[model samples]
Structures are given as C-alpha cells and as structure tokens.
Target: MQQTADRFPLSPRLFSFNYGRDSSAQTGCSVLDAAFKRYFSILFPEFTKDEFFDAWSEPKSFVVTVSVKSRGCDGYPDEDSDESYNLGVGDGQAVLRSVSVWGALRGLESLSQLVYQDDYGSYFINKTEIVDFPRFAYRGLLLDSSRHYLPLHAILKTLGAFHPFTHIYTQSDVKRVIEHARMRGIRVVPEFDSPGHTQSWGRGSVPSGTFGPLDPTVDSTYQFMERLLKEVKIVFPDSYLHLGGDEVSFSCWQSNPNVRKFMEKMGFGKDFTKLESFYMESIMNLTAALNRTSIVWQDVFDYHERPRSRYVVEVWKQGCYLCEMRRVTKAGLKVVLAAPFYLDLPIPTHSWARYYNVRPLAFLVLEIWKSEHYQTELSKMTKAGHRVLLSAPWYINHISYGQDWRNSYAVQPQNFSGTEEQKKLVIGGEVAMWGEYVDATNLTPRLWPRACAAAERLWSNEQLTLNADLAFPRLKEFRCELLRRGIQAEPLFVGHCKHEYDGL
Candidate 1:
C-alpha cells in the first residue's frame, strides 16, 4: 500500500458507482449487487430522502469502477481461488480490479475502509494505491454452535463481519447459514464432531438403550455416520469437512461389553487408542467416498502410527504444540494450529500483546510450546511439502475490560524463526469463538472489533500492518463503521463515536 500527499473530497450526494465491461455483466449477480448496495448504505447511513434523490439524479459525479477478469463466479470460494486485488484511488475516480469476484469483494472492503468523515461532516479520501492479497488462502473464523444454540440472525451478522467455518451443533440452521455465506463469497465448512462429541447425537442417532460416543464395534454406528455425512455433503457444497476426532472419553467404550469383546477378538487388549483409530479411519474413508476431504483434531495423528495423509489435523492442545506440529507435518499431513489462540481462556486486560507476540515458528528452546530448535523443525517440515493454517491469535469469546482487540491484532503468523520459503508454508489463520459461554445475545459485541483486527492481519501485508500503534485510530473509526452498520460492537476505550448507535 502506497499513499501520496494528495487528498480528494467526496460527497455522498454526488457520488456514483460504475462497473467495467466484465464487471457490468456481473451486476445481475446477487452477491456483488447486494454488497455494493450494502456498502453504499454504510457509507451514507444518515442520508435524507432529498439527498438520495439528488445523488440518483446527478449525471456528473465521482465514480468508482470495478472490473473482474473472470466472466462467471463460483457458487463458493475454494482453496485454489484467487483473492488478490489491486485498488487505486486518485484523480477524479477510483478503479478496483481483481482476477476473481472474491478479490473484488475484498477490494470493495478496502475501498470502504478508505473513506472517512471529517469534523465538518465532509467525506474525504487520501490518494492511495493498494496491491493487496491474503498471505494464506484459508483465512477463516470458527464458531462453535454445539455448547449453546446461536440464533440465525446472530450467525448472519457474524458472516457479515468476517469469513468463518462453523462448527455446527444439533440445533444449527444449516441451509440458511450456507445460503448467506455463499452470497458473501464465504465458504461454510461444517464440523460434525463424532465418536466423542456424540452426546448430542445419542437421542435419535443411536439405539434408545445406548447413549454416548458411537460404538466402534457395531455396524450400526458406521451406518448412522454414513447417513448423517451423506446429508452433510449435500447440504454443504464446500470441499472440506471437519470430522472432529477429539477428547474421546474411553470410559464409555470400555464399559461396553460388545466393544471389549470385539477388541479382544481383534487381538487388541485395553488399547483404546486403537479403537479410536478404527473409528476415525472408517469415517475418513466415508468422507473420501463422498469426494470431500476431512479435517480432524490432532489426536487422530498423535495416537495413530499411520493415519492417512489426505486429511488435515487441527492442533489445539496447549502443551508441546510445536512438537505436535512437527509430528503432523513430518508425516506429510497438513495442519491447522489452534493451540495458542484459545479465546475461551480469559486473561488480564492488554494481554493482547502476548497473543500478538506469538510467531508460528519462533521459540526459545524452552520446555513449553515454543522451542529454540524452530529452524530445524521448519526445515524438516518444508521438505515434507505441506501448508498449514493458524488459529492461534484471535479468540473473541473470552471477554476482558479495556481494549483487547490489540492483542488479536498483534499476532503475526510468519513472525517466527524461519526462511522466507518456510514462512510461505504458514498459509492462513482463524479466530475461534467457542459457544461454551457465548450465545446469540452477546455474540456480535464480543466478536466484532476484535475479529476485525484478525481480519486485517490475515488480509493485509504483514510488513505494512506490524505497527499496532498506527492502527489505533483506523480501528476506532472502523468500530464506528460497524456500529453504523448495526453490528453493536463494544467500545474500545473511554470514548465515543461521532455518530452514536441508536440501538435500532
């Protein structure tokens, strides 16, 4: 991003939007059209009826032109899709161009961020040129709907603020959530945690007499999983699915006579890990048959000797996270790191610096998660040739007084000890908001400005966004922008926005 000394005044009553030939053809696209209108309203929220009529009637007005190279848009964004964009704001007009519609959406977001209102109530923009792209392809947020049911409108508002991967519980409104996500160029990867979180599945999914984790020894278990996953594949068009293989309490399986009998017959005695392996492998094969990849918790790789390479491992345990990362990547499996960024654990105010200071690959040779031998670990993983997603920085559900967003903004995925090539393997990061204590009532205020910080870190260049101090005013303004858009974002400090929220 480059900025010059030049400034241009903008008038809400005399501003118009235009599209290039390719993008003009996309005007009929509901996603693009709706987004444009949404941003327009956000930019001019208080415009009167007369002002709107004057702006619509004006022939000579400042115009922003959007162009995309792709003729048609995809139903959903995928891993290989391009989200890079070039935005230029200068002269009499602004031009936004991208290779795909997804990039155009990002560019439009940047454009909206650039516009500001002055003390005199006049709109203005600085002369700026931004060539922006996500460092990682899969920047996302993970919301857990299992512990507590989140309302549909709250979920929609969340999607409006950030791209997310929803961990669906039994009560989620799946189809409506997916439809809303699709229109915003966001992919909804549904997580159906099984074999452990199956407490929710016991009512109708399993035999009435039995209730708990699916019995690995029974054919009925696999049958139920097949039917459930089949429906999931149809409902979620995304190519990836999260088959949670975490926190299995073996007591339930141990207590079952059938499971014990099957284990002994298979020459496996008291090895609960083996039972878990069997369950996960069957599910993975089922997912493959459905032509979708599976993502599981790190336990799948930790307990098994030869887990399949096609699946992704999410490392969320606190102790020895780097060791887990090395083990998973060395085995030629991709990983998503969720070890350090657990938002559910509350900390002191201004603790965001600790969150921000965590580099994905840096260590001090300590006994804890960060190790001094980071380079050696990174070199080995680079040879293995796989990318990793990070979920280590932003966990908004854990509340604190004062500005906690700075902590979220401080985390840099590539800030660790490694070569440029090794750093490139750090694909992207996600901010998780688990549902243990959070629900529809507090979801929006809890996630907004904090998650917004993570969003910028993932989307913008790290070098350009390293300074937290520089970002203060900008984020303060963005908080106001979100409020005007009806997000109900919490205040940053003991201050107020120029336009107060009316709680509509």
Candidate 2:
C-alpha cells in the first residue's frame, strides 16, 4: 500500500461542546463531541457514538497502538511491537505512535483523513496493520496565565473546544483533556507561566500601562503558584507542569524595593540573573516536591541560572544558531527547540528559507547551511542529547492582524528557510492560540484553516509544499468537512464574489 500521501497544498482547516449543564468532558467532551458526532453523522451515517469510544480496534480496522517509554527509542517503540510508521498513515503493516499532544493531533488528523476520506477526493488509508506509540512520553502545551488570566469557564471551554486535540491550558483543563488524550495514549502537559508573566492576576500591572506590576519575588505570588501547580498535578495525576520563565522586563523588581530586599535576605547577592535563578529554583523545588518536573524557558540559562535538571528549557529566541542550541543541551538538561518555529511573525519576508536554514546544531544539511557559526560548545550539548519542539502561534490577540495571520500561519513550516533534515527535526507543531483578540465572531474562522495547516505539517506530513494559494480546492473540501462538522470556517475565497467584505 502507498504510505506517503499525495502531497496536497496545505489546505489549513481544522472543534467543541456541551449542553446547558456542560456535558463536554467525560461524556464525549459533551459540547465538541456533540458537534463532532453530529457533523460526522451527517457525513457517515454508520459512525455511531459507541464506535467513537470503542478505544481498541483490530489490525483490520488499523489499530493505533500507543506506547509510553522512558528514554528515546529513536522515535520508535520496542522491537517486538506491531508494525511501525511515522505520523503519515500507510497500510496496517505498522501503526504510528507519538506521545506529543502535537503527535496525537497528527494521529487524529490521519484518522480523520481515513474517516473523512471522501471529503479529500480519492484519498483513503487503503490497507494497513500496526500499532503506534510515543518515545519521550510527554507531549504538551504551556499557557501563560501570568501574562493574562484565564477564568474557570474559559478553562472548561478549552477542554470542550480542544476535545478532539491533545491540548489543554490550565490545571483545571487537565483532568478533562486527559480523559480523552490519555485514552488515545497521549499525555497532557499543563504550564503555569509565573513570576514575570503573572502581573495580570497578582502584581496587577506591567510596564507603564500594558497591564501592571509583577513582583516576581512576592511571597503571595509563590503561595498562589505553589497551590495552583499542586492542584494541577492532582488533576493531571501524572503529567509535567510547565512553569513559564520568559519575557519579564525586570521592571517589576526595579519598582519594588521589597522584592530586592527579599532576595538579599535569601543569601543571593544583588545580581538579577541570580535572583531570577533563586525565584525559578523556588518554584522548581515546589513542583519537584510534588514529584512533578517543570518546563521553563531557556533564557533562564542565559547567565548561569541553574534551575535543577528537572526543569526543561523551551527555547524561544528568534535565531537558530548551533552554538545557542548546544549551550542548553550541554547543561545536562532536556531541551525542546522552539526558536525557529515562530509562526506568528506577520512578516512573510523573513522567508521559509531563513527558517529552514537555522540548524542551531552542526552536521546539518546544506539547506540549513548558513553563514551562522556552529560552535563546539553546542555540539557537545547535541552529543549529550536534547528534545526539539516546534511551536506555531495561534496567538490571535485583539491587536493581532485581522485575516492576515491566515495567509502566513498555515504554511509557516513548509515555507521554512532550511533543509529537509532540519524540517524533520521538528517533533511536532503546536497551534498556540494566545487568548487576546479572540472573543467570539472571528475566532473560529481565524483559527480553522490556519491551524489545520499546522496539523497537516505534523500529520500525513511528507513532501510538504506550503502553496497556500494552490490549496484552495483542497481547502474548500476540508472547509466543507469542518462545516459538515459544525466549525465555522471563513468563506471560500472566491474573489470577485457577488458580495463585499465589511470595509474594514
């Protein structure tokens, strides 16, 4: 059977739930499940509710065996396992396994393609036999509650909305997303972006007017984070909790002398990085005490900010220099490289070539060969080992460009500036929707086709060509499927249409 799918142009299109009482969680992610079932029912009359929850099917049905292993299996499980395949669907000769939420999302996309075959033209999961599994065992997403607060209702809404996917934001959303993600053998990694990002709820202000002040050293801040993180662990049972350690201007400390005084009393000298280390160490200790590891931004390592090895660095800087990537890996810690994966950049001129070219490590392909230097320091880190993460921002804040992020977001990965090897380095891609401008009307349309493109890159992701302009027909079919499923996608871009868009 043909494994590599016919590479279609990225037709990005990509969920939600509940009744009056909110039945979206355990019971089919009630809201989104209802929508999914209803939508699929319209398409396939035989798709019943029981079949959706059957959990286990046979090789004939194309079993998706998902296994959880401790160390790297070179992206495969035990040798005795069922047939093996990448995220792209092939024959039942092997199943695709991935622990990443992004991985599971990819799996879902593959299964979705199989289930919704007619929608995508002459496509079908012809014949296959296999089981799928994940290597590292923890695939996740981190939401910065510190920057902007997400209320309880929104948290539940996220559970419902992302029901079909492996992503859930808050600790509160874990138990819920887990019920589904875990059923598919995917892990739910929740993040608490504290310290600097927490101004939205605690310190109350940031900069002069952006939000307000955020005293990273505030005792109350620690108390709140401690309780929240602990509560989250309980909800998740067994999952990593992300402690966001990024983008703090340090003005919060400069403004508050008490924060400085607190640091000084702790025996840490008056160094900023040192203080940041202390702050992170404290949170790290708290999480460790609960037997949970933390996900922190890599900048914390900029000046010897030693956060225990339990804390993983999620690199987010713009450049993809080899020296920089090696530095974090050499520190004897796990790494998830997200720097070259910024999909939110509104500027298309940065070019995919630029993104694809950033290897941040040596011995890469010519496509990634650039004038940028690759140092031994990073090579050593590469030898020590690391985990690469790809993050695509679905961040549509209020100020985010209207309707434009669509053109750029979906194909960012394919449009990348590097070699094929570098592209494969991406374990998976995330549709990070930063809740800013998304209120109601445009959120659905703004995110659908674009996020689906991200999914396409991760799933059935062979021979990718981010020809957004060329994807209209396939996108229209995908959009029609989503519409059949109840998601409100943007109108098909039939230019010279019989109507006009609002003169915005």
Candidate 3:
C-alpha cells in the first residue's frame, strides 16, 4: 500500500530484485543515497531499511504469484510477469509486499522526497503481478556539457542532485523516488549531453570562442565519451541515453565549407539541418547497437526531416513548444517537458507555479507537416499514446550569488495548483544542474539542502504550502538539517526578493 505521497509506508514486509539478475548496488552511483537517508531520518526520525527488510524479506510465507495483470481499480486483467515480489504470506490472504527493479529504485528516490517520516513512500506499490515495461522503447535525460563543459564529477553530481526529485534513478538513500512512478510503472531514463552543449565539455573551461560540433565526426571524442558513458550507465540501466541535440551553434559547419561540402556529397544537400540529422542518425545507430535508446533534443526534427517515432525530444525552452513538441506530437513522436521546470531561472515564490503549469503538449497548435489545427498537443499525445516525462533544470547559471539555489525547491509546491490527489498526476520533477558556471569545486554547494527542497516537493505529498513566511523560519531548520547530513545550503533570507518583486 502506497502512503499516498512522498512518505514511506510502514510495510511489515520488503522484497528484492536485481539488475537483469545481478546483485543490488551497495554504494556510490549517486549522492542520492545520502540525500534519502538524511531526509528519511528527519521525517521518520526513526526506523531503518535494515529493520524493515529484516521483517519483510523473511523466507517462508504464503505469497501471491500472479498469472494475470491487474487492471486499474476497474478489475480487468491484462498480461503480466509471474515475477515474485516476496510478500511474507501469513493467512490465505496475502499482504502485498515485494520489490522489483522499478519499485526498489523508485523507493530509493521516494525516500529522498521525505514528505512524511513514517510513511516513507511505500503506499505507491500496487502488485499487479505481471511483467511490465516502458511503452516507449527509449527514454533519457540529456545533460548538456557542451554549453558548460561539466566534468565527470559534475555528471555524477547531477545524478545525485536529481535522485530525490526524480524516480529516474534510485537505490536506497532508504526510500525510492520512483515508487509512485513504478507503482504505475515507468522507466528510469538518464542522459549526458555532449558536443553541442559541449562548449564546456572540452579540456579546460571552454574558452569563449571555442565552440563547435561536439565531434560527432571525431573518433577521439568517441573514446572520451565511451569511458564516461560506460561508467555512468550502471547507475542508470533503463537502457536509454540522451545525446543533446538542440540549438547547436552551427559555427563549426558554417566555418568549414568543407564540412558543408561533405554533407552535400553525402546526399544531404546543402542544408545545415540535414547535417544535423546526419549526426542524429549516426548517434542513434551507435546507441541502438549498444541496446540503448537515442534520446535527443528537438533540433533533430528539422535535422532529419523524418518522423522519428523512436526519438524522445526533451523540450528545453519556449522555442521548443513553438517549434518541436507541437509538430513532433502531431507527427506521432514522444516527448517530455523541460520548460516550466527550468530551475536555474530562479523567481522566488510562485515562479515555479507557472512552470509547473506549463503543460508539455501545446494548448494550441499552429502547424504540423503543412497542416493547421488548434489542437491540445498533450491530449493528442496521450490519445495517440506517446510516452512522457518531467524535467526541471536547476542549472547554476540562473541562480543568484548567495541565494540557496538549492532552496529553489521551496518554490515547487507553489507551482502546482491542485489538491493532494491531483499532485499525484505530477509524475515527479528533476533537479537538473546544467554546467554553465558550475564545476566539481563549486557544484555541490550550489546544489545542496536547498535542492533538497525541490526534491521533497517533487516526491512528497502536497500537504506542504508555499508560504515564504512559514518556510523562511523552517528554511533555517532545513538548511541545518542538510548541513548535518553533509550538505550546506546558503543561509535563509526572508522575502529577500522584496526589493525586486515588491517593486514589480
């Protein structure tokens, strides 16, 4: 039984799963584990995963093995896996308890949400008893390093930063972010952007003038990325990788007439968009060969001039809504919203409220493949049945000098205009740390306890309000709480935006 929000439910039982059959991860794919444990202790102030698992995973018991898939409270059975979840059975009736790859990972993330201590997010589990999988074969989060050129450490830090806020990846920290997600069951997709957003990915801090193609055409670049991806993939094995492909400054191609000529010789004509599609197809093939999905940003739409059903276009800005997602959705492509959740663009109180309300599909469409229609894009998507996910960017560039960029989370709940029940529809949010001004040295501080606020808002119940008056005082306790957990947040300031917002 799920506790209904971010709170972990007291389950008398706990089960287990493996990576396609490997052992459970003990440590270090993300800082997420620490984030979860820290928050769990604060909320519950007691109880441990060890204690719960000890009782839940007990060997011999009556359990329900499923032969059919349970329908949504509608009682219609669907197909499912007979995979066992280990609920210790006592009487003829079985107490639903068990963990699979999806459930366990999500629980790890949910624990980080920390809405309530005792109910650390277990209620989300619904044992349907059938094998489930993602509808879209490919799902991913593309972290742009080209723009800010973040290091390996930053990438790891990003995964850690997003842990609690997203069920995209989890493994204890003691609860799961994906619990609610996995209960409904979704895939955990992660991405590492390079080349285009790679102005920052080159050697030393990318010099201002040194931006160009991420060397999708270079072998050396592949070698560098190969080692990086191999290491990070274990932390996120949902089998998708987002190769960021939006707004790539075509300077490299434009500067080198030979590069343009090369495209024309290759039958792509003289269009730079064709050149971009060449890059997309090339990467997709490489990733697909590795058994992963080629998730990219939206520029690929114009790049390929093909209806890419397999591609996942994560919309980064307003241009995406106007250009990509709307057209792509109409063309039968899957997508995710990254607009409203731009965590970097900090606007004190309800700034996120607008973002939270920024729906992924277009409320009205202007054109698609030469057709015109005023259609709700998201409805079309859900109707055509394409997969979707939520992305909230908390990159440092948009953050202020001393403001707890992490504290920006304090704004998320205010972002949602719904009842506790409706908040559940918010699959979850991601705390993205785009690497423009941040590096390993200053990264962690830029993303701590305050970031935890966003984490909590994403996974926890909507019970918390977005009142600065109430939160300002609590922010002190929370910041200290994070420091205690080894994360330091900037000191809290009440209505510091008064000078700015009050004037507005």
Task: Say which candidate scores most in TM-score.
Answer: 1
Q: What digit string (tens of lDDT, one per residue) describes model 1 on residues 121-175? A: 6677889999988866767788887677666667787882222344343324676
For model 3 the local lDDT of residue 48 reads 57
- Model 2: per-residue Cα lDDT over 1-504, one tens digit each: 244443221111111111222211233333233333543344344344455322223213333333222222222222122222244334432244443323433444445645433343322344433234433222233333332344434433332232223333444344555655433434556665756655444333344543433455668768877887767776765545677776666665756677778778887666666777777778888888888766666555554434444455554544333443444444444445443333334444313233222222233422232212122122222233433343322222211233342332232322232333332333333345554434333445555554444343343323332454444555556766666555655554443221223332
Candidate 3, residues 40-135: lDDT per residue as tens digits? 454444345566442233333222221112212211111131222323222222232223333333333333333322233332232212222222
Q: Single out the weakest 10-residue window by summed lDDT for candidate 2.
A: 9-18
Which runs in model 3 stand beyond 4 Å of their true positions? 1-96, 101-211, 214-238, 305-309, 319-324, 346-352, 359-397, 400-430, 440-445, 448-484, 490-504
lDDT accuracy of residue 385 in candidate 1: 45
Question: Could you estimate the TM-score for every candidate?
Answer: 0.88, 0.58, 0.52
What is every candidate's alpha-carbon RMSD to the true fold? 4.3, 10.6, 12.1
What's model 1's TM-score? Answer: 0.88
Better of 2 and 3 by lDDT: 2
